[model samples]
Target: MKKRLPLIFTSVLSLSVLLAGCGTTAKTGSTATPTTQATAAATTAATPAPKKDAEPFTVSLRHIQIGDAQKFRKAILDDVVKKTEGEIPGLKFELDGVEDQVNRFTKLPAEMAANNPPKIFDLFGGTGDALKFAKAGRLLDLTPIITELGIKDKFVNLSQFSLDGKVYGLPIGGSSEGFYYNVPMFEKYGIKPPTTWDELTAAAETLKKNGITPIAMGSKGAWVPNMLVNTLMGRYAGPDIVNQIPAGTKKWSDPEVVAALTTFQDWEKKGYFTKGELGLEYPDMLNQFVTGKAGMMFDGSWRSSVFKDPAQAKDLTNKVSYIALPGVANGKGDQTAINGNYSNGYGFSSSLKDNELKAVKAFIKNLYNEDMQVRGLLEDNLLPSMKLSDAAVGKVTDPIVKQVLESYKKAGSVFSHFDSTVPSDVYKETESQLQKLIAGKATPQEMADAIQKVQDAAIAKK
Candidate 1:
């Protein structure tokens, strides 16, 4: 959802295998053995006796797993919190849940600027977020903690969170951006899942003509529209364009990139997205789609679990399906490349006291492991960010998740969202330009030129 940098793996092979078949959907009741247990005896020989009664301390943990849709992820976090607290002498986690867009675009950046972020918080990787903070010495280098946890090699890609060979954060899960459509709505209209650009537009027209919003969208956060825009850009400009732009080898104002923006703007002019989408929030988009107000929605694969949860999805339970955006005719890039990202996750503040460090260590130990990774897949529909055992991947009864894996398998390659590849200033510029474009205040050429100007300055600064 946010931007990131070149992750550890140059290719998507690691995640491709993970998506092919991995992890269980079964809920686990196991409590993690204290990760520090092995070193306890060695530590006891050199350390002073601990006090029987320790002063209570609270570690602030800012997270984005808020709202009904995130309940499952929150439950997993609650379990880890419980286990971590049990192992710490007098530690308590002050969990603060905020909306994803606000946490990523507003609150977290302000906190990072003030050098007073919560002890642990949600983070995005790339030049704009984790890497930027890491360069400024605001984010803790998690290299040693991951190593001590014996999970340094477990993650599929850490490059997004790595700076100069030091790891800064760990992705919670892998995700791909695509369309999540209403199955019954498609059937009611006799429209099949669109796999070609013409078919996709035809389906939209069919739904729109029938008085249904063709696409469920919330533009209050530019990141929402940016998702579709990024995929389209990948189609027109080629998957390598994003990487080339940051290196000063390619320009954002390229004809193909502008064409992508133009295509998104065309959808806006056609009134394909929900009315007053600019006034709605991310959750509202999901609400509209789930209630049959819209025929389709472009979103991340992480959302697959929502359709399975009755409380969250309501009547939409077992009624939703997913599809990758159809390939554009005469597209320049790999038409089958899908948007995949392992860029969003938790990061710790660089400044921490002894007890806070211990809390951080315990948090990492309890959270980033095979068990929790599988739990994320099973309970939340999140693809595993860490490696699972050969026996871990089992029968996945959730059709939505199975479809997500199938979409990945069908893709010719995985292309990252541009936000993760560009400079933070350039990324913020794209967000601003996109909102303006959506509001009819800017043209596709204007948007591309504006973004390129910022990119030029950002590159000069380097």
Candidate 2:
């Protein structure tokens, strides 16, 4: 049988402390003698004219939807609305926003700054987060309400959503990134997975010695290379280090960061990756690894589904082993941490009127109920944020997803994926420079300096 996560705090809605539906009493008059004109005036005052001031109530629930997971979630939301419409009468949900991140975030912030905004929306969990809105007093304080609903105990990564001891949002899924290696190549070469930077380099050397490509990576989009660079940064300066760089407390050129970048440059020179990697695209990188041309690939854990896709080669499914990139030797950072995040969950707006608040609150309560939580795990292969029931755990059948979960267990903490914590302009500049850094056209210092300049400018604008 497959395994499931155990749930806690499941029955709060059924509690007797819940608010009762309020009732109103109609007015009655005492018997009295009245003139015809007085009685007519009294009757006219008691009657109401057409309700001229009433308006349609609407709440926009915005989210960036992409890929299979978002598709599944949208379907779930549709079902939820179907089941909930009658329970929250007169409430209108407008699902709004572009599916891509660029449009999603840009539009969201502008709306937030203006008079109109999505009343509740799914949010990213890192630096470019709902917390910024929360800090600006634009988001609702969900702390007391979440506590009442016992939602705080439902998620494992609430720390990511929390600010100044209060949570601003809840996550739909937990995100993790790590290495997925070809087990066949490792065993054939008598090479074990590395646990430190030196050991990892040694393993790469061994693979090169045997005419095997060490790491399968594509840098065409730039984001690909940052994964390795970010992981190296975590190992060198610890998880919180890069976070400071964006806030102007630290520079990208700090020696430790330089060292991390230098190491990244060194890896390229060592020929651990494919030739002209900056020209390679993502699919080619996956193809290289899955087809056994390379010994390992670095990517998102969500790729597990693709690895197991029936359309892909049979070799990938049976031969891959997911593992964390080894830590830096004698580094100041937490050796066991991973580059990860939680994303896609509701964030309430401060602008909601009383009726809107009540309706949205009820929706949030239903959103994380056991049924939806289980469906996310079983149908989506998501690292669910909600606590699960034993029955739900038993429904998870993917071994690779299970492995990814166990690997995350080794992390003492999770750092943001580099892009999530940096300004889009800064992130773009840094990612673009990574291609140059990888191709030996740019030195680590140059890359770091360029990144710092962009970040500094973005911060100044803020």
Candidate 3:
């Protein structure tokens, strides 16, 4: 997302006054009445005056292309804007329409550099593009403003938005990644959610023997397979080790990582994935799972909402259940250390006016207020980052939402999704390389070496 730069001259002028006052104050004698009064006056004058009943600036908004167009465009955005208006009095947001994911990724940074950038924009999860923008000084440091607004403590898992101890964004929602299985199919085949790696492989073999595709995967997007790979890494190497590789502490060629990749390749050979998955588009993979043509799918909690409506997922709704990705022996991570990442939130530009920053903060607070949080979960079927007072989830009729909420509450730790934590340029490389490893085009050692090369370059840049 692009941040709106604050009005720089005004802030600099105020800062200069404060600094000048500090430098000259001690030189003036306190015994002199004139000097004392002047010093006091200067100190008071140096303080930046707060806006008094100023008209709220209009914030032009753009969001990512939502999967559920009807709900997001028609319902969620309007509700948030309306609630914001109520909370911030005169604040207003003008929807500039949804930006396609590809366009948003490619065009938004340039747009932000232009004079007429949108006041707010939605950034995709896991691309690290937002962080890059922040590093370039395009994003506003919201930590101080967030603290002043008293919403800082409301954030759970602050680590999600923290890069080197500085917060560049707020996570508005979160979801977990795991295996989504067909309950009825499991019953019919006498299969159960796999509790161990061996059991998972056995189940996959059973499905293959019965001529049913064991896993429905969409490799066209490439990130889909990386999600599963991440899950496997978390289980086999544990969250700490897996996280270290990305952070430049651990080598990619660690034995645990090799074992996980080896297992992935073995599964591919055992016919665990959908035929022609490499050629299938993301939507087609989703369609296969929703239509019950596939026995299982590896996806996140967001998939629950996609499969909740019988009208949309006729064969999948009410039949789907999720479980933590199975574990291998010596897998030191707990089930709670599952694959997950924070939902996108707003980031401001450093050049925004104080009034504008205040307005943005107020708008955000209202958007995450108790009622909106409930509505986000219930009506829109989206998780809210705010901690809910009750798990009843009121209007969210989808059993899957309830299940997801339960799972989140019990989770021990959340790891950033594979693509989200990796640098934007290397994201596709990671995905493509992992695919090659799975296809037997590259050995696990070679895959590890390739990833190490990327990781080494990234760390050197840091």
Candidate 4:
């Protein structure tokens, strides 16, 4: 979700058509074939033998692995490989591992620029960085191939992935951050999911009274704290405020931001979070919630997929349910202003060989085919970027998916999170200040002032 510079298209016609329909299939008939003509044979004969293959070349893919890859090997990866192979007849795929989110941000970019870079990379966070690469002529202009394949309409949220009206990446799925609670625990305590800020606090108080932790949060990652802050801002000041902060039209020291931090600090003081959460890792915190040691968790939709996976989380699936973050009662913000964004997807490198480019387009088109999209949703609990009939989603039992889709349908607008849109330096500083504020080491005013100073400096740099 980190924001990078907006990409500029080298040629308007080259990338403009990439942002069209969300269900059109790619045309396969017109794709160029790899053959050695007299002129090509002359060059090919002189090329190093190590770099040449007898058939269409294979593309190396670097994928971001968030959970247990072994579990999804057969279910997701293997299937994708088989499909890609069938789509791009003679082409092959070589897989590489990206262990976690941090690696995707810090290591993947440098790796991509090296000689013999991976042809396809799974971009994490947002398409901003991918767009930057595209603008720099590092990513292929997929518009022509996508149009030729007639699959331009198969992508969803194309507008979000476009820079200066040109599309640079494809959105695979979407996600939202919300609260997941234990239904049996709620039933046992005769407590209901919170719908408003007052109700949320009361629920936490009730849980405390019953000797249960109110929330299971992991603060070691720093981003977790930012998530809570952004959600609180959405609840109090509305989604538009986030946009204003990034555009320099509003200061971070606004009273609304102060109120949000005050509320978070107040909750921390009241012992709403798990004890010693600051020292706990994200996996440990998630395990605490899944094992029934905690009553609720604040996380994104990806976690919901975990619960639904019988092999991964059999115990937690049947007992879980999700609800939107509690709204501020009669507040300015709408109840549906949930924090969300498109998930990781595919992008092509501009430096791809002619044959490799065709193979890449064919593979992407096949991946977004209706059958595959439905399979991805039903098997992976991933909402497809391509359009699907309601029946295709009928098998998804995860409560969070339904809630997230509904939230998307009703969202008046959506905005990226603070850490996601702010400069890296400002984002890191804000995260540190937020941690300090939560630890009772910094006052709300002090935190607000620190954020304001960083924002001012960032603006001055511009």
lDDT of 2 by residue, 1-462 (tens): 123222222243233123222422233553332333445776899999876743557777776655443565567777776555556767777877465445445777787678466777767655566666777787787888888888768776776567898888788776677788888788899888776667777888898999889899888867777878888888887788868888788788898889889888887888998877878977788888888878888887756666555456456665677778777766666888887767557778878788798777787777767788777665555677877767777787777778777777778977876666776678778877888888777999999999898888888987
Q: Give the TM-score of candidate 4.
A: 0.80
Deviating ranges (above 4 Å) for candidate 2: 1-59, 68-78, 90-100, 113-116, 164-166, 184-199, 202-213, 243-250, 274-294, 311-315, 353-359, 387-397, 412-414, 418-429, 439-441, 454-462
Looking at candidate 4, the ten consecutive residues that score lowest on lDDT are 30-39
Model 4, runs deviating above 4 Å: 1-53, 69-74, 86-90, 112-117, 125-128, 394-398, 409-412
lDDT of each structure? 0.89, 0.74, 0.70, 0.71
Q: TM-score each candidate.
A: 0.87, 0.72, 0.77, 0.80
Query: Candidate 3, which ten residues in sequence have the lowest lDDT sum?
Result: 65-74
* Most accurate candidate by lDDT: 1
Q: Which stretches of candidate 3 lie over 4 Å from their true place?
A: 1-58, 69-74, 83-105, 109-117, 124-127, 163-166, 333-336, 353-359, 391-398, 406-412, 438-440
List the candidates ranked by lDDT, beginning with the highest.
1, 2, 4, 3
TM-score of 3: 0.77
* Residues 182-280 of candidate 1: C-alpha lDDT, one tens digit per residue: 998899999988988989999999999999999999989888889999999999998888788999998999999999999999999999999998899
- Steric collisions counted per model: 10, 2, 9, 11
Instruction: Decide which is better by TM-score, 1 or 4.
Output: 1
- On TM-score, the stronger of 3 and 4 is 4
Clashes of 1: 10
